[model samples]
Target: MEINELTEPERRVWEAFPRGAAVDLTGAPEREIRARVLRSLLLTAPTEDGEIAGLRLLGARVTGELDLQYGLIPCAVTLWDCDFERTPRLYGAEFRQLNLSKSRLPALWAATLRVDGVLRLTDCRIPGPVALAGARIAGALFMDRAVLGTESDGSQEWRDRAGRALQLDHATIGDDLWGPHLTVFGKARLDGATVTGVVQLDSARFHHPSDTALDAETLAVGTDLHAMRMRVEGRLNLRGATIPGQLNLAFARLANPGGVALRASGCTAGEFWMREAAPVEGALNLRRARFDLLHIAPEVWPGEVRTDGLTYTALAPVLPAADRLALPLRDPDGYVPYAYEQLTASYRRIGDDAAARTVQLAKQRRHRTTLPLYGRLWGHLQDVTVGYGFRPMRAAGWLLGLLLLGALVYGLHHPRPLKADEAPAFNALAYSLDLLLPIVDFGQERAYTPAGAYQWLSYLLIAAGWILATTFVAGVNRAVNRP
Candidate 1:
C-alpha cells in the first residue's frame, strides 16, 4: 500500500513527518492526532533493510491505542532507531504486539509519556528522564538493560520511568525482567508488577527501599533478594519496604547496624537470608510469614529475637525461687493442678534441697486444705513420729544396759571370732551393712568392773527390769508424780 492510500487523518499524520532517511516527527503535539500517527505506525510498522522511516519526535504525546497484534503484515523497513535527541515522545505506539527491542530511543528529552501497550524491549536502551509514573496498562513493559534517567542530580531517584506504581498486571514473558545493577537514584515503583514468569535480577542493586516500590508491599528492606550476592552491588537501603508476598533473600548481605536492611513484615515466600548479617534495630517481622522454620536461622525462635541472635526462649526466669503453693492451676474443667506434683518437678530441676523441702511442706499444707488424702497421710506420719521416733530415741539409754548384758555373755562365751587384728572386707556397701546391723540391733557394752558374780547378776537383773518396764509402759506413778 502506497503512503497516500492511508486514511486522511493518517495521511495528515504521515505528512507531519519529514520524509528523509529517518523521518523527523520531533515537534508533534501530545494530542489525539499524534496518538493516531503512532497508532498507524503500530498497525502498519515498517520492516526490511531501509530506514524509510526515521521519525525524530522531539516532543509529542501519542496517546492512541491500536490493537496491532502479530501477523498484521510486518512492514518490511529497516527501522533501526529513533532520534528524539531533544524531543520527549511516544513513537511506535502499540496496544498489542510491540517488539521494539533494538529501537534507538531519544535521550533525556524530559518527557512524561505512557505506552499503554505491550512494550517488548528485549535489548532496547533508552537515555534520559522518563516519567511513566502513574501509567496503568495491561501488557508486558520490558526494559532489560534498558537504562532510564541520567546519573546527574537525580542520582538518588528512579525517575527514569515515572514517580511510582509502574503497573504490570500479569505481564507474562518468557525471559526474566533483568535489571539487576541499574541504579534508580529515585524510587522505582513496580508495586504490583505481577509477572507469571521468572523475573531474574542476577545482580541488580536497588539504592533504597523507600524510592524503589510503588506500594512496594513485597520488597525486603532488611535483606536483599539476591542470587548468591550477584544480583546486588553496594549498600542497599530498604528502611520500611513491605513484602506482601514471597521474597527470596538468599545469600544477600545486609549493612544496617540496627536498622533492618529489609523489612519483610508480612511477606509470604521461600527461604530468606536473615542469618549471619548485621544487627537490626527495626523489626524483622515475619509475623505471618509462611516460611519454613528450617529456612529461618537456627537461632530464630518463635518469638522475636533481638538482632544479636538472642531469643525469648533463652530468657525464662530461674524457675521461681519458691513454689506457688498459694496459687491455683485451674483447667477448663475447674480441676486444680496437683500442688505436690508441681513442686516436686520444679524442685528436682532446680537442684535446691532447701527449697525442695520448703516446697514439699507448702505442698503438703495446701494438699491438706484441698484434698482428702492429706488427713490420713499426715496423721499417720505424726503417729509414727511419736511411737517410733520418740521411743527409739528415748529407750536408747536402758536398752544400752540390756545390750551390754547380752554382749558380755556372748563375748565371754564366744570370744573374738578371729583376733581383733582380723582383716575387714573393703566393699563400702558390705562394710556399711555390717555397721548398720550392729547399730540397729545392739548397743555398746558397759565398762566391766568384775565386782563379784553375785553383784554383777543383781545389777544386770535390775537393768533388764528397767528396760522391760520402759518398753512395755511408762510407769504410772513416775509420770503422775513428775509435775
Candidate 2:
C-alpha cells in the first residue's frame, strides 16, 4: 500500500518501521489500525539498504485478526499495550521475536509457532485460552503477571472436560519459561514440555477446582522448577517429570479435598523444598519419586500421604529420629514397609545411625499391626522386653527386676533339704541364681527342694527366666537379620 493512501496512524507506523523506532500512542485517542496494514509493513523493506526494519507500535487497537499462519517474518514484531479485536493466529508461523506485552486479547492461537528470540506476554489480560502446543522458542517465554481465562462460563461441558487455559504441551524453550504472578482459571497443561532453563511460577494462582489445575506430566526441566508461594485450588500433577535442579514449592497453598493436592509420582529432582508451606488439604502422592534432598517441615505434613517407593538421599533441618518418624506414620496406605525402609535409609545415608535405628524400630511396631493375633502377641513380647532389639537396655532392666523379685521371695521362706548331708547352705540369692540360670547349675537348687508356696516361687522364677531369654534372643535375631 502507498503511503499517500494510508491512514494517519498507518502512515506514522509505516514511517517508524524503517528505523525500528517505537511509536508510542499512549493516552491518545484510540485509532483503528488494520492487521493487514501492519503485516504489509513488516513484509516491506526500508528504502535505504543500511537501515534496520522492524515494527514497534504501542497503544493501538488492531481492527482485524493478525493472521500470520505459516508466514515467516524476518524482523521483530512488538505491539505493546495494544488491543486485538480477535485472537492473533500465528499457527506454524516463524518470527525473529514477538512481544505483545500489556495487550488485551481474547486469546492467542499460536500452536506450532517458532520464535528465534524471546516471546513476551507480560501483564496481558487474556480472557481465553493461550495455546502454544508444539511451539519452539530459542529464548525465554515470559508471561509475568498475565491473567489467562475467565471465571467459569456456566458451561458444564467445558468444566467436565477440564478446559485448558494455557496449553504448552510439547513446547520446547531454550531459556526459562517465567510466569510469576500469573493467574489462570482453568488447567494449565504443559505435558511433555522441555525447558532448558528454569520454569518459575512464583505466586501464580491456578483455579480448576475438583480437577487438575496444573498438569505437567513428563516435563523435562534442565534447571529449577520454582513455584514458591503459588496457590492452587486443584491438583498439581507433575508425574514423570525430571528436574535436574530444585523443585521448590515453599509457602505454597494447595487444596483439592478428597483428592491429591500434589501428585509427583516417578518425578526426579535434585532437591525438593516445601519448607514453611501451608497445610495441604488433600493427600500428597510421591510414590516412586526420587530426590537428592527433601526439605519439608513436619508441621506442614498432611494427614494422608502416599509415599510408597519414594526415596530421598537426605532430609533437611536435621530433625531427631522420633520427630521425623511421623512421615512414614502418615502414609495412608496402611503401613507401607517401603516408606519406613526409605526413611531409615535416608537417615543412614546422613550418618545418623541412632535415627536410622529409631525409624527401623517404628517400622517393626507399625508392621505388628498387620500381623495375625499370634504374631502380634510375639511382637508385643519382644517389644516390651527389648524394644524389638532397638532398645537393648530394656532387656537388662527386665533381667534386674526379675532377679530382685525372685531373691526377695525365696529369702522370705526356707526350703526343705532333699538330704541333710547333701545340703550346703540356705542362701536365698544363691538359690535364686541357680533357678534363673538354666544353662549353668548351682549346687544349692539341686541340694534343697522348696515345698508348697516356696516350690511355686521356684517354678515362677524358672518360667520368667525362660520367657526373658527367648524374647531377648528373638529380638537380637530380628535386628541382626534386618536389611
Candidate 3:
C-alpha cells in the first residue's frame, strides 16, 4: 500500500517506525492506534534496500483488538512501556517474536497464539488474568519480576480468595519458564502445560490462602521444577505430573492448614528434594508418587505426610537409616504400613538388608501400639519369643533356659524309680531332657514321676518346650520368605 493510500492512523504508524532497527516512539503524540491501522502498517511496511524491518512500538497507547486470526506476522513485534485500554485479544495470532515487557494491560487472551521467538512479559503489572491456553512458544516465556493480582486490602477474606491470575494450560514452551521473585496474589495455573526446560519460580511469593496458589496438574517438565525459597499460602498441586529432573522444594514454605498443602499423587520425578523446607502446616500427599532418590530431613518433615503407594529407590546418602525411620514413627496416625514399606523398599533397593530388617521390625512394634489389649499382649509374646520374626535366636535362648531349669529341678527331686531295673542315680539329666523335648521320650518321663511341686515342674517344662519350638520354626520361616 502506498503512503498516500494509507489511512491517517496507518500513515502515522508507518511514518513513525524507523527501518532496520528499533524505533523510540516515546516522543510522538500519544495516539490510540486502531487494530486495523496497526495491522496494515505491520503487514505492508516501507521497504529499505529490498528488505522490510520489524515493527517495534515503544511508549504507544494501543486500542482495539490486536487480532491476527487470519494472517502470520512476517517480522517481530516489540512493545515496551505501552498502555492498552483493553485486553490484547490476539487469539490464534502467529508472530515471529513478541515482547511486551514493562507494559500495562488489563488482561491477555492469547489462546493458541504462536510465537517463533521469545515472548517476554517481564516486569509487567498485570492485575487481571493472563491466559495463554494452547499457545506454542518456540523460545522462552520470561515473566520474571512480574506483579500479578490485585493489591491486598488487609481483609483475610480478600487475601484468601484465589481469583484467576495466570493460566498456561496446555501451552507448549520450547524453552524454560523462568519467573523468579515474581509475586502473585492469586492462583498460577499451569495445568497440562509442557515445558522442555526448567520451570523456575525461585523466591516467588504466592499469597492465596483459601484456594490453590499454584496448580500444575499433569504438567510435564523436561527439567527440574525449582521452587526453592518460595512462599506459598495455599496448596501446590502437581498430581499426575512427570518431571524428568528433580522437583526441588528445598527451603520452600507451603502453608494450607487443615487441608493438603502439596499433592503430587501419581507423579513421577527423577529425584525429589525437600531438605530444610519449612514445616508444612497441612498434609503432604505423595500417594503413588515415584522417585529415584529422596533428599529430605526428619526435622522438616511435616506431622502428616501420606506415603501410601509412594515409593523411592534410594535415600540421600547423608541421611542415616535411623533418621529416615524416625519421621514415620513420629506420625500421629500411628503405624502406616505403606510408610514402612516405602522405607523398607528404599533400603532393599540399595541392597541394605540390615536396614530393611530394622525398618520392618520397627513397623511391627509401631503397629502393636494401635492394637487391642489382647493383641498387644500377643505382640509382646511374639517379641520375647521370636523378636517379631527378625531374631529366631531369642527363641533358642528361651529353650536353653527351660532345659537347664528342668534338669536342676529333676536332680533336686531325686525321684524313686518305677522300674526295678532302673537305678536311683539313673541319669536325671536324661529325664529332664525327655520332659523338655516333647517329641522325644527317652523312657525317663514315664519310668519315674516327681512328687508334689516337682511334678508341676515336669508339666511346665513340657508346655514351654512346645511354645518355644513352634515360635522358633515360625520365625525362621518368616525370615527366609521375607525377601
Candidate 4:
C-alpha cells in the first residue's frame, strides 16, 4: 500500500518515527493499535530519528485473539514510535523476535510474549509501567537501556522486572531499573512486583557480559527468591538487588532439583548480599558452591566443597547444633558426606577394632538425644567418641558397684536349693541346678531376664559389656587423639 493508504493513527506514528519508521502488518488492522503505540514511542524517545514525528492511522488496526497453539498473530512486523495505553491483549501471541533497537517502547504491556528469535529492545524508553505479569516469552528479551519504569502513575510506584515473568536469561539489562536495580534476566523478577502471578525459571541463565551486562553490577532478582520448581539452567546473580520478598532458593538447581535434590545448588554468588532481602518462609539455598563465608543454613555447604577431589578448606563453621549429636557416620577413607561424617569414619579406621568399637559407642551415647536417627551402635562410636571412651579406673568403679549390689541381692534372696549334694562341698545336684535355673527364669519370664548362675552368668555379661565399652574407648582415641 502507498504511504497515503495508511490510517490516520498509522500516518501519525510513521511521521513521529524516524524517516524509515514502517509497520508492515497483515489481517484486520485497527487504528487504536497505531495511536497507542505511537504515543508510547514519543514518551520514551522525544524524537526517534533526531526529528519530529506524529501518529494518525488512516487504515485499520491489526487485532487478533491470542493463539498459543500456532502462536498466530496478524501484527507480525511491528514498527517503531508506538505507545501502548493498554497491553493490547495478544493472549498467546507467538512470533519471531521483534527488533526495536532504534524505536521507542512506552507502557509495553503484555501477559505473555513468545518469540522464536531475539526480542531485542536495544535503546528505548518507557512512559508508564511495563506489565508482563504472566507473559511467557521464548528466546532472549534484550533490553539494553530500555527503561522498565513507571511514569507519574500517582504515589504507588513500582519496579522493572516485576509481574509474572520475562524469560531473558543471559539477556542484558543496562539500567538501575525504575526503583530497584534488578537484572531483567529471568522468567520472573516479581519478588515484590505487586502482581501475584506465579513466576517460573525452569532453567534460565542470568548474565550478559556482552551488551547490557557490563553497564550494571547487580543482575537478576530471583537471587533472593525460589523458582518454586522451575529449572535453572544458568547462574543466578544478585550481587546487589533489593529483595522486598522472601528468598527461596531451596529445591531448585542449575542442573536438576529432582535427580539429586539440590537445596540451593545453582546459585554461585560468592557473597550472596541479601542484606536488603526479606526473610524467606522456608529456606534459602547455597548448595554446591564454594563460599568463603556463607550466611545460609549449613546445608548450603553440607561439609566442605571439595574442588577436584582435593583437601578443601572448610568455608563455613560446622554448625555446633548440627554436629552436637553423633550420626551413623559412614567410612572415613571413602567419600565424605559432610564434615561430621569424617569424624565418624576416622573412628572406624582407628588402627584397632577394639578401639574403634569403643569410639563408636561413645558417639552413639553422646548424640543419642540430638541425633536419634543416626544413633547406630557402630556409627555413634565412630563420630562422637562419647564420655572420654571408658577409662580403666572408671570402668573398675562401675564394675565394683555392680558387683557389690549383686552380692548383696544374692546373699539376701538365694533360691532354695533344688537339690543338695551328698559329696563334701561339690554338690552334683546343685551343678545341675546351675544351668537349669537360668533356663527356667529367663525362658518362663518371656523377658530379657539376667541369668541366675551368679558366678558364670555374671562373668559372661561382664565380658560383653567390656567388649562394647572397649570399642568406644578405642574409637575416641582414633578420632580426637589424631591430628
Candidate 5:
C-alpha cells in the first residue's frame, strides 16, 4: 500500500507505526480503520534506524475480522479503547505483546496463540466466549474488570457453551494471571492449565448457576491463587490442583445449593485461607485434599463438609475440639474415620494434646454408632470407665470409687477366717486392694470367707473387680497401640 493511495487516517497510523507513536482517534470524525491495512503494516512496515517499531492505536473503530492466524507479528500491538466489528482471529499467531484494553468486541478467538510478553485485555467488554486454549504467554495475562460473555441467546450452541465464557484449558502462563474485579457471565475454565506465578481473581463475579462457575481442575500454580471476596453462583471446582502457595478465599461467597460449592478434592496447597467467608450454601468437599495450614472460621462452615482423607498440618484461630469436630461430625458420608484421625493429627501437630485427645474421644463416640448391639454395650462400658482410652484420668477415678466402695462394705462386717494359722491380718483396705487387683495376692481374700449376705457382697465385689480390670486393660492397650 503506497502512502499516496492510503486514506488520511490510515496514512497517519502507517507513519506512526515505525516510531511506535500513538495515534489517538478519540473524538475524531474519521475513526474507521481497515483491519487488513493494520495487518499489512504490522507484517511489512519498516522501522526507523535503531527505533523499535510498534503499532499503538487508540479509540479506533476496526472494521472486518483481524485475521492474523499463524502470522508472526514483529512488533508489539496495542489497540486500546477500540471497537471491533467482528471477533479477531489470532489462532496460532505469535507476538511480542498484545494489549486490547477497554475494547468492545463480540469475542476473541486466540487459541494456540503465543506471546513473548504480557497480554492485556483489561477492562474490555466481550459479549461472547474468549478462547485462549493452548496459549503460551511468557508474561502476565491481565483481564482486570473485563466482562466476558452475555446472557444466553436461547440457542443450542449458546447453551452448550454457557459455562465456558473464558477458556484457557491446557494453557501455560509463564507469569501471573491478574483478573481482579472481572465479571464472567459463564464459567472460566482453566482445566490442566499451568501458571508460573500467582493467579489473582479477587472480587471477581462468576455466574453459571447450573454448572461450574470456575473450573480449574488439575491446574498447577506456582504461587498463591487469590480469589478473596469473589462471588460464584455455581461450583468453584479446583479438584486435583497443586498450588504450592496459599489459596486465599477470604470473604468469598460461593453458592450451589444441595451440591458441592467448592469441590477441591485432591488439591494440594501450602495454606488454605477461607476465614470470614460466607457460609457456603452447599456441601464443601475437601476430600483427600492436603494443606500445610488450613485457616477457616468454625462458624463459617457449611452444614455439610466432606473431609474424608483430608489432611492439614495446622489449623488457624486454634478452635476448641468441639468446634473442630463439627467438620467430620457434619460429613454427609457418615462414619469417615480418616476425617477424625486427620483432625486429631492436626491438633497433635499444633502441640494441643488435650484437643487431640478430645478429637480421639469424639471419634470413638462416633464409631460406637456403627457397631452392633453388644459392641455398643462394650463401647459404653469403655466410655464410662476410660473415655475409650482418650481420657486416662477417668479410669483412675473409677478405680478409686470402686476401691472405696469395696473397703467400706467389708470393713463393717469382718469375714470369718478359713484357716486361722495361715491367715494374715484382717485389714479391710488390704483385702479390698487384693480383691480389686486380679493379679496381686495379699492373701487376705484367700484366707477369709464371708458368710450369708456378706458372701453375696464378696461375689459382687469380685465381679466388679474383674469388669474394671478388663476395661482398664483394654483402654491401656488401645492407647498404647494407637499411632
Candidate 6:
C-alpha cells in the first residue's frame, strides 16, 4: 500500500522508515513509537516485493510497555539503531521476524516467545539481564558481537547482583543460536535446552568468577556445541548434558581454582574435542560421563579431572598402561574404585583384556599402598597366598617350597617306622608327599612318628597344606565371578 493510503498512526510509523529507492534508516528522528501504533502496523501492514513491509523505527526512542503477551505479531519488526526508554515486554509473544540490532535497551523479558524467523540482537547494548527462558525459535537467535551487560565500574553492587546475563532455560531452537564474540557478565543459563542445531559460543567472554559462568546442565544438542577459545572466569556447568555430536572446547580457558570448574556428571557425547586446551584450575567433575571418542592425550588430561564414573569407547591415539592410569590416579579426594572399574570396562569394551587387567591390578596395588601398616602386611600375605585372587600360580609356588622343606627334614632325621609290617623301600619324597596331601593318606604318617626337628617339620607341612587349599578355592571363585 502507498504511504498516503495508510491510517494516521500507521502513516506515522511508516514515516519513521527511511524513504528512498534504497531504504536506509540512518537519520530518522527520535520519535516516540508507542506499543499501540507498532501493534496496529504489525496487524495491518501491506506487502512490498513479496515481503511484509516491516515498520522500520530506526533512530527512534520507543516508549511505553510493548506488552504482547500471548499476542501473535503478524509482520516483521526491525528497530535498528533505536533507543528504548523501557524494554519491550513480549512474554509468550509470537513474531514473524524481529531485528533489534544496534538498539540500546535496559532489559529484555521475552520468556517463552516464539520467533518464526531470526531474532537478531547483534551489537546491541543490554545493561540488564536478557530472559529467554522456555523460548522456541524456529530459526536462529543471533547475538553475535553483542554486549550483554554493562561494564563494571569497580562497583561491588553491580557485581553482586549479576545473576544471569542471558537466561535460556528449557528453550528449544530448531536452528542454531549464534553468539560468537559476545561479552556476558554473569551466567549464561541454558539448563534443559534442546537445540536442534549448533550452539556456537566461540570467543565469548564471561566474567562471573567463583560461580557458574555458563550453566548448560542437561542440555541436549542435536549437533555439535562449539565453545572454542571461549574464556570463562568462573565454572562451566555441563552436568548431565547430552551432545549427540562433538563438544568442541579447544583452547577454552576456565578458571575457578579449587572449586568446580566443569561439572559434567552423567553427560553423553558422541565425541569430545578438547585437545591442546588451557588447563582448568579447579575440579572437573566427570562422574558417569560417557563419550564415544576422546581427542585428548593422557598427559594433557586435566590434573583435577574427577573421573569416578567416566567411560569412553576409544581414545584418539590409544595410550599405554601408565598414561591410561594417570588421570584416575590423580583423584585428589583419594582412590575411587569405580574410576578404575570404568577404565577396566572401557578397555574390555575395546577387546583389550590385558589393559583391563592392568587397571585392576593397579587399583589393588594403590589401595594396598594407602592402607595402614597391619593392613599392608595382610595385603601382602593375601598376594603371596592367592595372588590377590588373580594369580593361581603363586599358590603352587608356596606349596612346592613347603614340600622341599619337609623332605629335607625327613631325610636328615631318618625317623624310625612305626609299623614293622611296612615295606623297606622308604622314600623321603614319598613321605613328604603323603604329609602334604592331607586328603590321600599313604600310611606314611601312621607308619612313622618323627623325632626332634622332624616332628616340627611335619606340623609345619600340615598347616601350610591347609592354608594353600583354602586360598586356591577362594582364587578360583573370584576368577569365576568376575565379569
lDDT leader: 5
TM match of model 5 to true structure: 0.93
lDDT of 1 by residue, 1-483 (tens): 467666544455455333423332344442223444454564555544444433333222333332222223232222223332233333222233334444445432211223334444444445444434333334444555554433334433434343421323222332234444443433344443344334444434443332322234543322233333322212232323332333444444433333333444345444344443333323243323333221333322212221211111111223443523333221111223343444444455545544444455454444455546767586455334323222433444444445465445434543222333443322322322222233331111221222356345536544444443454344333223332
**Poorly placed runs, candidate 5 (over 4 Å):** 2-5, 151-158, 451-456, 466-483
**Alpha-carbon lDDT of model 3:** 0.80
Task: Locate the minimum summed-lDDT window of 10 residues in model 3.
Answer: 16-25
Among the numbered candidates, top TM-score falls to: 5
The alpha-carbon lDDT assigned to residue 161 of candidate 4 equals: 32
lDDT tens per residue, model 3, 93-165? 8888999998888878788989998999998888887878899999999988888887667686555444678
- What TM-score would candidate 1 get against the native? 0.39
Lowest lDDT 10-mer window, candidate 4? 208-217
In candidate 2, how many Å is residue 297 off?
1.7
The ten-residue window of minimal lDDT in model 1 covers 306-315
lDDT of 2 by residue, 47-116 (tens): 4467778889899999888888898888899999999998899999999999999999989999999999
lDDT of each: 0.37, 0.88, 0.80, 0.36, 0.89, 0.78
TM-score of each: 0.39, 0.90, 0.85, 0.35, 0.93, 0.77
> What is residue 215's positional error in candidate 1, in angstroms?
5.9
Could you tell which candidate, 4 or 6, scores higher by lDDT? Answer: 6
* Better model by lDDT: candidate 1 vs candidate 2: 2
Error in Å for residue 445 of model 5: 0.7
Off by over 4 Å in 3: 1-13, 16-18, 25-37, 43-46, 61-71, 154-161, 317-322, 326-335, 369-373, 415-420, 423-456, 466-483
